[model samples]
Target: MQISSNEIAWRGGKVVLVLPLPGVKQTPPDSPQLQALYAKLEGARSGGAAVAPRLPAADYHQCPRGTSVRWYCFYQNRDWNENVAGRRLQWSDPHCDEVMDFEVYSFAGQTSSWVNTGFLEVTVWDDSVHRLWTEAPNSLSAYVGSSNNDQARFFEACA
Candidate 1:
């Protein structure tokens, strides 16, 4: 398989990439974890938009360290809990538009639990955002999560 620098890992025959959302990299549909993230974003499934890639440090060169970013979190009872790809997100409010974050996953084989998926971060406003890292999200949170519960949940692990 062709590989590039963006590859975070290729565990258990499944690739775990961490690039920008809607990035040049493509997530193979066969990869459930990655594809599921792609499916979560609106217009991705119905409009055939490309899934966003994971966040890279270079993407935030000019952004400040404590800008405050946000991301999406979605849980389904005891089944699975997934997040919205970061690039697909947009500015929620002036207070929330400060920043956001991005990352990706592709769990396979024995990895069945939510935490086992190995991808979830807090990023902006609680009602609609969470700031995991102090780095500014730049353009990552331009348009992504909404107030929709099943569709979205925003929180930050660290501020």
Candidate 2:
């Protein structure tokens, strides 16, 4: 579940994650969110490859004032209805590569909870990929959502 640092890039003012499409049997057969992700990967690859972005500036939304020269960052959607909060307060060397814990979840209308679907160790870059790795235990589920209307959110961290 790793996309090497060289594969990540910035396009259209957003970070472009070039993901390898997983085979039908590789992902949980019942998780539509995973299926959607696979479709998205296919589309992105069909469109173009990734090119890393330029270095981030101190004034970027995610970077804390005076700390962006060596800071980790992410866009946090605390309440998905409104705007997402960009944060980059963690400290790290400007030239070092970081690994981050990433989780994909689907909203369950019946349970009113997020169902874990795909978990991966993703690499982040200060250029645009700011989240860093964390450790946690979770129970994975095959049927993450009951319908296609279920919303999916990716949770990542900056460390």
Candidate 3:
């Protein structure tokens, strides 16, 4: 199912189960979790559309250390429990408009962090079918590199 809106529910509130595109089976109405989620969405819907937050790019750069920068890929999946074997990271960039790949990571209930697997390289192709690539140093220290696209691509390739 296609998720048309990144922001669901109404303004000044929270969203429960992000409604998947229509035609996707609605969550079981009797389920308690589903009920709670429905209530939040209903409140948002009645409250109007002004409550949603603006979403940033699919992937973005961040500086963990004062001088070092790293890339991060963000996403969510219903099946993404705390112990999934693999997670897919998707992102976009100038070199590659869209890229998706599986990566090794551990989710702690709802959040997960990427772990380096030692192989750092962008092994995906751009929208035009041209392969996009980059090289990463053993340590992602300051001045080493600074691009979420490259970091995400490398993890995806390793997976």
The superposed Cα distance between candidate 1 and the true structure at residue 100, in angstroms, equals 3.7
Residue 118 error, candidate 3, Å: 4.8
1-159 per-residue lDDT for model 2 (tens digits)? 222421232322123222223432121111333223334443453464332223334223222122111223322222211232211112222222433223311111111111111122223322234332221212212222333112222234222
Lowest summed lDDT over 10 consecutive residues: which window, candidate 1?
A: 108-117
For candidate 3, give the lDDT of residue 55: 26
RMSD of 3: 16.7
Per-residue CA lDDT of candidate 1, range 49-157, in tens?
A: 5444334464332111111222322222122212322111211122233332222232211111122111223342332353222223222232232332232233333
State the lDDT at 99 in candidate 3. 42
Name the regions of candidate 1 deviating beyond 4 angstroms.
1-78, 81-151, 155-159
lDDT of 3 by residue, 1-159 (tens): 212232222212221123233444432112344234334444454564322222234321110111111223222322221232322232212223334433322211221232211233335333344444333422222121232232332222331
Clashing pairs in 2: 99-133, 100-132, 100-133, 101-133
